[model samples]
Target: MQGIELTLQDEAATIELGEDLALALKAGDCLALSGDLGAGKSTLARAFLRAMADDEALEVPSPTFTLVQTYDLRIPVSHFDLYRLADVSELDELGFDEALSDGICLVEWPENALAALPKSRLTATFSHLGDGRTVTIAGEAAALSRIERSLAIRAFLRERGYGHAKRRHLSGDASARAYERILVAGEPVRILMDSARHTPGPILQDGKYYQQLAHLAEDVIPFVAIDSDIRTKGFCAPEIYESDLDAGILLIEDLGSDGILDADGRPIAERYLESVRVLAHLHAQPVTRDISLGTITHHIPDFDRRAMKIETSLLLDWYLPWKRGEKASDTERTGYFAVWDQLIDLMASSEKKLLLRDFHSPNIIWRGERSGFERIGIIDFQDSMIGPTAYDVASITQDARVTIEPDLRDIMLSLYCAERNALGAFDETLFRRDWHLMSAQRNCKLVGIWVRLMQRDGKPFYMKHMPRTFSYLEVALQHEALAPLRDWCIKAGIL
Candidate 1:
């Protein structure tokens, strides 16, 4: 898509452009504004700040003398005028890295410090066009595309000479795919897209297998199944109007704003209990049929035991370094494997139930209504299998990153056990022992996964959660059932 082009004829137009840009600004965004003196750079910056901060009268003076001005908005905003800098060394002294790490930055005369600035920074060049000016914006192709869309939408409104207001929204690959599939399938669906990136893959389909997967998904997921048969007596997921599973495409119902995760993005207290209930409901139904896992893992390009071991070795490789601030020795590595072997054995002995292997925070949505806990919506169940219940429970309570409050965790565990007892399949003591064992195992695997995310996938965001995952493992090791494993971790120096 082409980048957005805007012609500013008056102060109102400039402010309108600022508002448009504000909608697209995210944390850590850098905007380089280049223009001659009196090009209304400060005026445009003021408008952008006002749109974000909601304070129209906020002062935004030129940083001619100071070189940089900072503003505390919904997120941090930095205004820099490199026009006055004597050398790039001045920027280094001013803590430029600290500012960019936390907020959006606006730099005027960025060329003066070009060598020292980030390569990915956005550039907005302003030039005098008759009484006003022409603004040319360039940045990452995706960001530029958004700037273009905003300009188009703004121009559409301006032609009508009426002010427009609406809640700001951002679209990701998943959302774009959802929209594309709906268009192709001729189905109406409501989808709310967010900026979070959980899994890695394309979000839409352009081929036959993807279309077939979408059709199969529509058949299996409960939401669509319920719509097909009104007599079906269960809360399924909302009908997926369209999907392209191969492409990660989906056009689904808006499950509303009440997700199982709290407002601060933490998993809600009852989530653990609700997840177990869902698993019980699924497993209660006799499996009088068969199912396939998927082609991703099935079609092994080249499966070798050594290769698999190398891939799994990433747990000790990356996680141990980040956690211990050093790499594991030969003896320590052997101990790690021994612990994993024991945990796997424990998992094998547990009673098997249908397992959503990744039944963790991101996969669940909170419905908030409180009718038999049907409020919880499940996603990412394509990896579901017939496995032990402890696996799913471990995925929820001792999540790799998000820490569930102890009080809530205890309450939810009690609720799940009680529900199983009411259903005549209760084994509280065994469940407790298995729960700790599984939690320790899962966290161990997560430490590896998180490390892989950073070093292999080139995503460092997961690294920040390493300490929490280590802490979970530490607590799990302290349990009486996990005493041996705890000692092993200590011997390996992972404790």
Candidate 2:
């Protein structure tokens, strides 16, 4: 799992390797570089730093004289040149420990401090190979595994005629999936999805993994199936150009960068209304459960009582303890479940449609130039299921990332209801009830998720949305059906 060898034909190839490494390594990582003075160690380090900064023209002077240079970029980096006969004790004065604690470290002439470098550090050794250079990368199994997968993606893209395409990081979600935009010489932009198969966590219940119990997609089959199915039904899902199901990689159409939010991250009313209209058009008809591809059929999972309860219980399992600094008592826990069980029973009888579990602003793309449903580009529907239509409505109205003002939220809801009413057989009263119910349900899950993200996942940025979520929960709690849960939350000091 160690010692990956690559041959770089010229300076460009070496720079590309450094760019690829930037995507693989993270904070608290150290890459030890070793080579002769004229070798490509310093070149590779410079390229790596520039890539990390996302600036090819970023001035990165050699640290040979100063001995160390640090840049506080996205994932802060420290460049150290240790060829000055420096004693190992000099590292203590150079703040080596603090540097590694805060961000990544790249050491040239690591041989000078062989006893001081971390054993888990990745090592990249360069040597002259014919007219170019040969680089050997060795690292701990976990780090090497990341690099291996990244190289596999390069191979996949190369086989698909995008070998020379420039890769730029777009985003990474809460899941393991990462996305990159591909820029070719004279072709339309494309997207590369690196959804490596991630089977996370131990068996949490019923001898199944947590993802299995929650009906989350472990690989890319569900995404491919759902994307194909939705596109066929006139939705504007991205077109898939290439796929490696075994490797969990995809080269798909780029759906542009226009979203329903503005530069300040506020929701645009016109775009939000269009998104609602698109959903109304969709939920008016029954969705096919089993989607067929050329050789494989994917059956969409059901948002059954078990899955819903598992989600709702997160509020009890994480949020309550996190807020109150202790676990809920047995009696309080029993009362909470009793209320959710009743709510789920009521939702079980509502109209069912394909529910995009996360239909928020982050997953939506605004195609203003296109008309009708084509104006909305949908992504991140892999966890979609056959569930109550009101759920998706709630997801957008009370978006997790953006705040939808009260008047705009009402207008969006009215647009959806009016559209469905014109389509016939739509009970506005029943839909409103389910809307409130689902909103409360969704907000509960989000409150717990924000806390869980901070407490368990070491991501505290999501916690900034907690107050907004709590405010949304207050709106949902005004409903009479959620009175029991609302009272419980009030007593629990969360309402």
Candidate 3:
């Protein structure tokens, strides 16, 4: 994870490094500048600080005499010049711990108080190399690993003829994957997807890890495969420019910023209608389980009983315990899975289609210039699988994040059924039945996921979506097929 000797050819190169580092940096990260006065440490520090601030003209006077300078920027930053400190004991008076805890810290002359500095911080030692500068980075394993990944991303871009592309940070998902916009001078903007190889967790089922059991794609192969197939089918999947499958890096075409949501962050009727139509069209098509990719074919996993059971078990494992403050015993766990197993099997009434996994607003890119279903640009489909078509319909319409109102949700269901039945030989009644079951299952899984995100990932932001998710679960469980599960929840006082 650690990188060594990265030579900066000029001031611009130094600035570029800072920009790239800015994408990798988070709050509570510390950058220890251990370099000679003329080695451009302050210049590099200022470059990073300015980039994070998104204000290149923001005056960043050297923290030489001021000792520490705080910025009211994105993810608050504290720049410290420890050169004049009499002893490490002065760190407490300067609020050093508080600065490190709250923001990204850039410490100049960190060698002066080396013993006081945390070992987890990245230390960049800069030295003169003719007119340029050479920076040798060293840090604790985790810090070094992150820096190494960022540097590898730099190399990935360079190899793809985007050596001078300006990297801009983009929003990340709940998953570990990271993304950035790579803007080249005279070329179309592209996305830099950092889908690092998933480090497998402990075994969960039949000697398989949780991701494996859940059919989650560990590398970028599924994404590349699914994207290629999606584009071939005339949808707007981002075109891949470069891919290092082993390294888990992809440079793909940017699909612009038109989302299915409006400026108010609410779902637009036409856009959402088109989204349902897009799903209907996809479900109607003859989709093969295997996706052709050059000489290698990617086989989309089945939404089998094991995966479904494991997913639903998340409710028992995380949400139920969190909500009730008491874990389910062996009898309850077995009974819970048995109920979902029967409910999920009811979804087999309709022919299976490739479940886009996350067919919701957040992942849907709206392209106004395109016509009909093609206007709905799909992303975040590496976890696609052969499953009941109703699953995706339930997913988007009964979205856990967005509250699509009851009337609108009804309209969406009708629109989807109209499109699917228009093709003839479609069973409207069966689809709705399966849709209800899928909605319940999906919402149940989501409640658990939200709780797990809060307790395990330290991401309590998803907790706000729980009430909506729980409400959807109630609507889904209203179906007679989900009575046992509903009764169990009521008995457990979770309903």
What lDDT is obtained when candidate 3 is compared to the true structure? 0.86
lDDT of 2 at 365: 97
Off by over 4 Å in 2: none
Comparing 1 with 2 on lDDT, the higher-scoring candidate is 2
Over 4 Å off, model 3: 1-3, 86-90
TM-scores for candidates 1 onward, in order: 0.59, 0.96, 0.96
For residues 391-488, could you state the per-residue lDDT of candidate 3 as single tens digits?
99998898767889998899999998898889877888888888888888788789999999899998899999998998998998888877988998
* Candidate 2 backbone collisions, by pair: none
Mark the 10 consecutive residues where model 2 has the least summed lDDT. 161-170
TM-score of 2: 0.96
